[model samples]
Target: MNTTTQPTHNTLFITCFAALVATSFCFVLRAFVVDDWGHEFNLSATQKGELLGVGLWPFSISIVLLSLLIDRVGFRAVLWVAVACHLIGTTTTLLATGYWSLYVGTFVLALGNGAVEAAVNPLIATAYRHDKTKWLNMLHAGWPGGLVLGGLLALAQGGGVDWRWKIGLVIVPVIVYSILLLRQRFPVSERVAAGVSYREMLAEAGYVSALIVAALIVIEVGRVFDWSLLLQGLLIVAATAFYAWYTRSPGRALFIIMLIIMMPLATTELGTDSWITSLLEPEVVSMGLQPGWVLVYTSALMLVLRLFAGPLVHRFSPLGLLALCSAIAAVGLYGLSQATGVAVLLAATIYGIGKSFFWPTSIGFVAEQFPKGGAVTMNVLAGVGMLGVGIVGSVLLGTIQDRAIGHSLAAHDAQHATQLHATYFTSEKTGVFGRYLALDEAKVNASDAQTRAVVDAVVAGSKKTALKSVAVLPLIMLAAYLLLLLYFRRQGGYRAVALTQSPPAA
Candidate 1:
């Protein structure tokens, strides 16, 4: 029972919006400042990948843990934890000197981001139960909204600002959300308010979903501790067996299927977006566009489209809209891979429109289809997506670019290749870490004319090849979405599941 005075819907909406802004603010900063970090620290590609991925993987931990606890501990308490993490994370980031400190700071920052999603998603659902999809899309518009603000600020700095100032963007939103959320009443989760038992909520996530989360945890933890793969594999197997025995219900198979699909969906969109600025920098510069402007443009497209998702959802249906968007995004990505000069804008617009609706619409689909699953369902889906980006997407993008560039450079100048390899590449684990090459922006800029020409060719080729590879993910998602549309169609079209309220105890 929520005993405190209920907050106005306007206040909650604004606060939730701010929380997402802060989240995106943290995420988008990597695009602007990661090269700076690499240059300053002489970090390898593996180290940079770890650094950026740290900013994401911890999201999985915080969201999964908080999802299980939020209903029990209450929304206010979980929000305060988010605030604390943000403050602490910012302090760590400002003080960071090298690889270890930067990783810790990013990890802490991601914890707060995950907590925000865990709290706010359910908050909005409880606040505007009838319009979860529309409100959620509107709430999520803040993601690209933050990107626009952050990207413009980076561009204004002429891409030369202190990394600290760029990172400080989150502070304003943190303070605003804190003020808006404090002392306000928080409703019980829809599941709790409707008198659904706690056990039922846990069961909705199921053993399979739990196994996936657990396996990711093992993979991440093993990476940090330098644990052997054999050891990690055994731990994951044990976790799977334990969850299978623990969860008696076969669980919501359809929801579980969506969770699986979320891996590629998340990796393809957020992962690709994270690298957009760097990948397109050469072409954008050649065309006299500010490098960061392309990101701002794409983000603006997403912000506008998400704000109007209500009508589109009504017309196309959520799954139908996703299928259409996936096809467009695939074409956009392929177009981007092949684009040059001012042609990049057209390609970006298509990509932006394609990716804009993916994250929020997917959330809406799960919410509408599995309302009985409650916070766990929503938060786990979110957790899976974040983990995918942090673990698979970030590392994969970084590694492929490194390898492609290395391959190109090796063929161009063997001596320069040696220098570049010494400067950029490093060895780490097999799966995500592998061999990474981190190019130095300062070094590349200062190279002699012949050397600069060679470097340019390598970067351009690597980026194009990487984009073409990632375009495959959206193509896969298109097929999956189409199949889901057919599934829903056969079942009398998409419909929201409404749990019947239990009468109060006599």
Candidate 2:
């Protein structure tokens, strides 16, 4: 009934295009806002984490809201409303000189960004019905694509522009997309096309349940993305027995549980897919080179990879490609955790390439299996990813850093676990005492104070770094997703074997 070669009339294309812009805007805003505000806010550790989480928070909230709203009004209305919110939010950020204002503005921007996803994700399924998963991958890849642009600008040119100018920069993309959507005529959802009821639309996101399962897995095993052998063994037996009774494989149980483990992993991976610019600062500092520039180069490659993702997914089978990519990412993240200097910079770049396709492939896999609920799945995946950034950053990574290098370094990032008031991230701000508690270790190595100073320093630093760098959890999760991708290759296209092959004759 519908046929169009170009995206000109492709509702998904136009809406996805807009979604791409919105996604890019959200990450870009998040990427730079942290750096700019860090300078302006002189923020405490808790404030900084909260500030960063603001970008992630609105996204999660928007996902739930969008899931419910799209079932009612459909996408066009949601898309426009989202764009309007982003515009207002971005514009208001210029007025922010304090915490609450900045929070409100960033949240509004995320709201709009979240809304874009609500529309485009389901739109991808509805539009490209056959390749819903592939298209969804392509569509969601827009996020890393946006991050590519966002990070490049923020890291490379960030110093020259004021935060106001940075916020202003989004206006161009916003205006261009608004114009494109205006010119295009869109369509109703796949549910509308097939005459399915709204109740079914709600159930479409089987992957959302899957995401919850994966989120739990990540929490339980502490393995970012790999399946716990124990969990998998239990699932295999359960699924086999369950399938003996019903026509449909009861694997959905495993899928849901998997999300509990994997959703957080995926989200953590993406959040940390950020530029290497924020690598911890040593006590002795200089202006000559900042890690941000390293991030710029890494982000540039990320953009380039995303642009080619359409073809890559076509060739490698999305899941296989993701596994390979994630393996590369795992090495990168672990390496970053342990390495330093230019070597660390190089590792981050390697991590970047590995990270390039993790989300796209995973999102694509979900879209293929759970077309109707793609938006909800995307939200869960995306939302959990945001929260992963917070949790791993606030909890996991901080603990590791404290134990390994917190006391050795000039900064002791932890010191909060000692208090009953322990929230997500509180130690990174407790002040010079925290710093000296760790730094004084070098001076007192021979003094009677050595034992107490070092012990105190490690605890505090671990806490601090755990919160500071939990974003790495997602990067590690990417590796886990990659393995899962290999397992699910049949469900999507692109097998593991093909990942190693060169592109076929065009």
Candidate 3:
């Protein structure tokens, strides 16, 4: 880590941007092709949600695990690992034959995505330490930028193109970033540069945050392996005890609060994006527009706004901006639930603007507020956000849609509902939230046109209702952000904490 010979800031920033573009390409493409997977795999809505969830939750594991080792391992080494994961993950996805194959592929892909964030986030924060929020926002513009590109490319191929070809698009950016970063000198992290001890860095996250992350990992892993509840509980307890003994602290109160807030915040942003196309499909189709256009259009909005986040941060302050956006997001989601046809675009505009800053700004806030935590605090927040959405949010929304459709159909036409239930509905399936039945796509496809029509109408209404259900998440976020704003005002004002050479008293 020599300072003089390291790559210029612009060069490193561009390389980081390219790496993020590669990750976002995978995300948007998978989201676009999810319906295709549902058709091919004869999946229930819950199962489709599981696929999407797996694509995200595994991100937490790789990110948290790698964050612990990144400072010791160096950025170049960790990035090369990410590059390998990307290649293997994409190849696995391309060769998929069924749901299990798709699951494995997506799981691997998420690991690569996690690794990318683990390396790049701290890299940018270190490069522009004085103005982390602005540079980090600029760094993340690459995400929506990739989405806009990937979504448009997928859309351009028309509906008739093979999904395998669409998935292959991820490889192009992967190659581009790998080439850009090749042989580039990397810098020591801000924590290291500031002479912050590793023990102090671990102290910032403390025991409580570690327990939350550990519990999530244990629960999800247990579910995957069908581990007994006793085993899962023991693992969580053991992990928490070790962390508490070592850290001897409950964690900073504000940082702990932020971690809790991340759950709904993540659901409102990434969870909704994951399902937007499917949720709005019927309305968008009726208007003779591709469902994907909505995702691309919203992503485009996010891209432009994120590029200009500096002024907003300066004007509203990070927490203030977050509070305002959460309110807008709540309104936007409710509007989406009620909007129809062309009006859907208008509602999406508000949502696009509202969610545009949530992810990057939240990261910027964590990096600024907890600079002593270095990559661990920032990446852990990100990991927790993904874990929350993947295990809870995405699956919960799908379950909501499933339950709503069943009830709506039964109420509308009991005899038809009974027949459909006997013939087309899946048996009860269990998820993180609870057990629920879902429509079996294969059987539904085999039903008569009249049956399909009735089911489709019910399905559309259910999707809308699901959006309304999710609207509560942003409202929850709004309350949390407002409280944070009030707390910061009482402390004189919001300000980024600067690291000093000597560690502050514990």
Give per-model CA RMSD.
2.7, 10.2, 2.2
Off by over 4 Å in 2: 1-15, 152-161, 204-251, 254-258, 280-287, 314-316, 390-506
Candidate 1 C-alpha lDDT tens digits along 7-34: 5667778888988898888888877787
Lowest summed lDDT window (length 10), candidate 1 = 422-431
**Per-residue error (Å), model 1, residue 55:** 1.6
Reference-based lDDT, each prediction: 0.82, 0.54, 0.89
Q: Which tens-of-lDDT digit does each residue in 280-354 have in candidate 2? A: 333101335644554555656666777667777777766566657756766776666565456656666777787
Q: Which candidate leads the pack in TM-score?
A: 3
Q: Please, what is the TM-score per model? A: 0.93, 0.70, 0.97
lDDT of 3 by residue, 1-506 (tens): 32733347788889899999998998999989998998887777777788888888898998999999999998887788889989999999999999889999999999999999999999999988889988898899999999999999999999889899999999999999999878576777889878888888888998999999999999998998889999999999999899889888888989999999998999998899999999999999999999999999999999999898999988998888898899988988999999998899999999999999998899999999999999999999999999999998998888888888788866766754366655666656777766777787877888899889988998999999989999999899888888888888899999999986443345
> How much lDDT does candidate 1 score?
0.82
Maximum-lDDT candidate = 3
Worst 10 residues of 2 by lDDT: 495-504
Show where candidate 1 strays beyond 4 Å.
1-7, 414-449, 503-506
What is the descending lDDT order? 3, 1, 2
Q: Candidates ranked by TM-score, best first?
A: 3, 1, 2
